[model samples]
Target: MLRQSSRFVVNRASAALVGRGRRFSTDLPAETGGDSKFVDDWKKVIPNLEPPKTPSAYMKPRPQTPSTIPSKLTVNLVLPYDSALSAKEVDMVIVPASTGQMGVLPGHVATIAELKPGVLSVHEGNDVTKYFLSGGFAFVHANSITDIVAIEATPLDQIDIASVQKGLTEFQQKLNSASTDLEKAQAQIGVDVHSALNAALTG
Candidate 1:
């Protein structure tokens, strides 16, 4: 009987020890699996850090800074009382040249033309502004600058045609009556100016 009781107690203690060992073994695998999974997840999110790569010959070159050189006509038109027109990047300027009616453009050849009494036309894009200049000197520079020094500049619409015609008739009468060379020459100049002005207004 004593031997049987001792055998039963030993069996219970062995079963308890086996159950504790199984729990330890199962918990160890779960804990280890969770830790390994956490490490793998962190590794996936983290990025490898390195310095940025420089351009190679295979890559296209980046755009460089544009040159500071001017590429348009710079006109400085001035009158005695005020600055008439100071235009940069003007498309074209037309004036009555002593040689003929002339148009000044960007990068034109260097020339100095004496302006006469006519409509001075300044063109920019699609808009044109006309100014009746009595007389002026246009200096064209090779560096794309045009300087217009006008004695008098008035808007084309301001001058009345009737007044110009009356002046023309008076100048013509003065030219016919003049007995001296200087008087005839001066009167002729007046007639020519009035005729040009009339032409400008009508044309």
Candidate 2:
């Protein structure tokens, strides 16, 4: 008797859904460019309440992928205070990733790499520029666009080798004399950064 009653209830529910001819909430809304379909329905249900705008209304549309890969990669290197490079097209870029130095070229696969304290190189036709970065991230997009954000970046030529050598020696002494874990860690970081700077300059 209970089974028959349950079946009847389910049958009635299904019949009602079929009879109404209205799509369920799970059904996809028709494409209306960027506007939300829910906003239209909400306005009809509650005329007094203001409808909220969707993120699509505020966000800009992404560029469509081209059939052929681009010849040059568009790069943008940004720092905290200023833009280092903006919309510059280059043949290749080499970044010091945590794993190793990664070389990126045009039509490279999308990737996000964690940077380390090392040199970042940008290669054009005949000229190559180098910069030393403290640390940051590199984002490679599918559209042959690369974005680099660094905590600190200085031109390779501007770095002082003498200062780096002095700091390295001082940090080595501090690391040897450090008694606490925090001190050791701090000294180690200083040593690593100085070492990287020295290597970038000499190597």
Candidate 3:
């Protein structure tokens, strides 16, 4: 009886030690560095099976950093249905960010700015082209590349003053008469957009 009890205790201690080792191993993260450590382990277990490809494997390698910044800033402006500008080199661009108007030039720091309803201006020499953008985003890359994407964009000169004023007045009335929360929100958006449009044209 004594021998049996001692043997049972020894078995339980061995099982507890195995369970503790497994728990510690799972808690530790795999040291993958750059390459996959699991890839080697899988190959040992299943020699014929191929390892899955990682995201880095499919992505293009980034270009090496240049010693000096380029003179011109490459700008790509696109709309939903069209590419407004592509690979165009310019001296500067002024974007209407949510924070405020932001001027970007060559060697500008990498940034992503949320655009608001306002005017976007592209500068080349003394000539400047302006456009009214409804809303979008601007991406500034470290390699002197700037991308502007907008839902709706129109040339500043093309907007009709009479139409904008009419829309603003109509939306203002709707906002005042709005009963539901959704109606109020929609009317508010219209008013804000039209107001921005009027301000862009006049200012």
Best TM-score among the predictions, by candidate number? 2
* Candidate 3 or 1, higher lDDT: 3
Query: Once model 3 is optimally superposed onto the true structure by TM-score, how far is the C-alpha of residue 25 displaced, in angstroms?
Result: 36
- Residue-wise lDDT of candidate 1 within 1-203, one digit each (tens)? 45554454465447747845422111223222423433343344433422122223123322221244355678888998898877556888998888888998776766789988888898889988899888889987655677899998888888999999999999999999999999999999999999999999887
Report the error of model 2 at residue 69, Å: 0.9
Give the TM-score comparing model 1 with the true structure, all chains together.
0.63
Q: What residue pairs clash in candidate 2, if any at all?
A: none
TM-score rank order: 2, 3, 1
Tens-place lDDT per residue, model 3, 27-87, is: 2233333235545654655556565554444444433334688899889899999998998
lDDT of candidates 1 onward, in order: 0.72, 0.82, 0.80
Question: Model 2, 1-203: lDDT tens per residue?
Answer: 45554464465447647856533211223343544545665456555666556555554554544568989988999999989999999999999999999999988877889999999999999899999999999988767888999989999999899999999999999999999999999999999999999999998
Provide TM-scores for the models: 0.63, 0.73, 0.72
Candidate 2 achieves a global lDDT of 0.82
Rank order (by lDDT, best first): 2, 3, 1
* Candidate 2 Cα deviation (angstroms), residue 93: 0.3
